[model samples]
Target: MSGFASWIGGALGWTLGGPIGAAIGFAIGAAVDKATSKGLLLEPPKRGSQQRRKRVDPVYEKRRRRKTVREKQAQTKSGDFEVSLLVLSAIVMKVDGEVSESEKDFVRNYFTKMYGKQRANHAFKLFNGLLKKEDISTRQICQQIQMYMDHSSRLQLLHYLFGVTKADGHVDESEVDLIEKIAGYLYINDRDFQSIKAMFYNPVDSAYKILEIDKSATNNEIKKAYRKMAKKFHPDKLEHLGEEHMKGANEKFQKVQKAYEQLQKERGF
Candidate 1:
C-alpha cells in the first residue's frame, strides 16, 4: 500500500483498537504482502517513520493573509473616524466659551455607546493628544470633519454637537459661533442649519405659531414656503446688504428652515 493509505488505515485501526493492536495489524499486513511478493517476512513500521506532507494549499493561505490585512485596514479606519469625531465634538463643546459637566457627560456617554468602554477610553486619549496641540485651528478641525463624514452623517454630527452645547440647558454665543464655523465647513447653508435647530430646539406650540402654518399643511405648500423663505434669506442674495446685515439674515434664514422642518415632521409630511 502507499504510504498515505497505510497511514490512514493505521490511524483508523489505532482509533478503533489500541496502540498494540494497531502495531500487530500493521505487522501482519506487511508480512503477508512481503511473503506473497518476495517470499520474505516484514516487520511492523515504526511509529515515527512517516513524515507529514507540508500544506500546499497556496490559495487558502493567500486568502487567510488577505483577510488579516483587511481586518487591519478596517481597524485603522475605525480608529481614524473615532479620533476625528472626538476632537470635533470637543471643539464644539468648548465653543460656547465653556465646557460644563453636563457637556462632558454627554461626550463621555456618546463615546461609550459608540465604541464601548475600552475603545472609548482610547478615543479619549487621542482627544487629549489633539487638544494639547496649540496650533490646531477650530476651522481646520471642522473642515476635516466635513471631508470625512457624509452629508447626512455630518448633519447628525452637527445635531449631536448642538446637543452637547445645549446640555447645560443654555446655548452660549461661543457655541453658536463654533456651530456656524462647522456649518460653513460642511457647506450647510445658514438656512439649513437653522432648520435643523428649530426641529430640535423649538417648542412645539411656538414653532407652529411662528411658521403661521397649520399642522396639516399639504406637502406642496410646505415645499412652497421653504423655497420662498430660502430665496428671501439666501446669503448670496443678501450680500449687497453688507456683512453685518447678511450675517443676521443668514441666522434668521436658518431659523426659518428649522421651523419649517419641525412643522413638517409634526404633520408627517
Candidate 2:
C-alpha cells in the first residue's frame, strides 16, 4: 500500500477526491482487507467510519492546494480513464443480480488486450472488490466523470459499458436502463447515446440508429448524418490516450462506416 500511495500521486492527481475517490478507496480497502485490516484508506472515510486516512504528504498536499482550477482538470490521464472504467464496470456487472463468468472474462480480455496481463489482473481484483460493494451511486460517479473527463473519453466509457452488458450473450433490460442512466448523467445526449447503444444490438433498424438517423430521413440527410457521425467517432479524437486505446474507438468508428454503407446501399445514393 505504501508504494501504491506514491504511485497514486501522479496517476490520479484529479480523481483523488469526490465520490469516485471514495468508491475506489473503498474498493481497494475491501481487497486489501483480506491481507491486513489496519491500513489507512486512499481518502478519508466518513466521520464514524472504522478506517482512517493515512497521513498526508506535507509537500504534496501543499503543491496540490496551490494548483489552479484549470491545472487540476488538466488532460485526463490514461490511468484516470482505466480507474473510471473499473468503477463503472463494477456497477454494471452487478446490475443483473448475478455476476457471470462471461462478464468477468469480457473485462479480463478487454484490459489484457489494452494493458497486458499484470494490469488486467489488477483491474479484475479491484473490480471484484467493487462488486462486493453495496452503496455505489451511479449518478455520483458519472457526475464526477462529467466534471473531469472529455466527451470523447466519456463516450468511450459508454461504448465499453454496452459491450459489458451484452457479454453474457444478451443484454438484460435492467442493464440497458443502468447504462442509459449513466450516459445521461455523463451529459451524453439521447441521439449520441442511441448511436453508441446501437453498436451492440442487431435489429433491422440498428444501422440507422448507429448513424443516429431516422428511417424516414431523406437520402441527402443520411449522407450528411453519416459524415457527421463519422467525424464524431473518428479514432483521432482519442489519439491523446495513445495508439493502444484507439482500438476501441476505432471499433465504434468502423461501425459508423458500416452503418453508412448500409444506408447508401439502401438509398442508392
The estimated TM-scores of all candidates read 0.48, 0.83
Q: Write the per-residue lDDT of candidate 2 for residues 130-234, one digit (tens) a residue.
A: 889999998998988887788888899999999899888977899999988999999999999998988888778999999888899999888899899988999
Q: Which stretches of candidate 1 lie over 4 Å from their true place?
A: 1-80, 203-219, 223-269
Q: What is candidate 1's lDDT per residue for 1-269, written digit by digit as tens?
A: 34423332322211222322222234334433533344222334568758886787999989987676445333323333344456567667655555677776776777676556754554454444444444446665555445434444454456666767777787787777778777888777765576556545665564543344455667787777777756655666534323423443455567667767876786677
**Residue-pair clash count for candidate 2:** 0
Each candidate's root-mean-square deviation in Å?
25.5, 6.8
Cα displacement (Å) at residue 110, model 2: 0.5
Compared with the true structure, all predictions reach lDDT values of 0.54, 0.81
Pairs that collide, model 2: none
> Largest TM-score belongs to which candidate?
2
TM-score of 1: 0.48
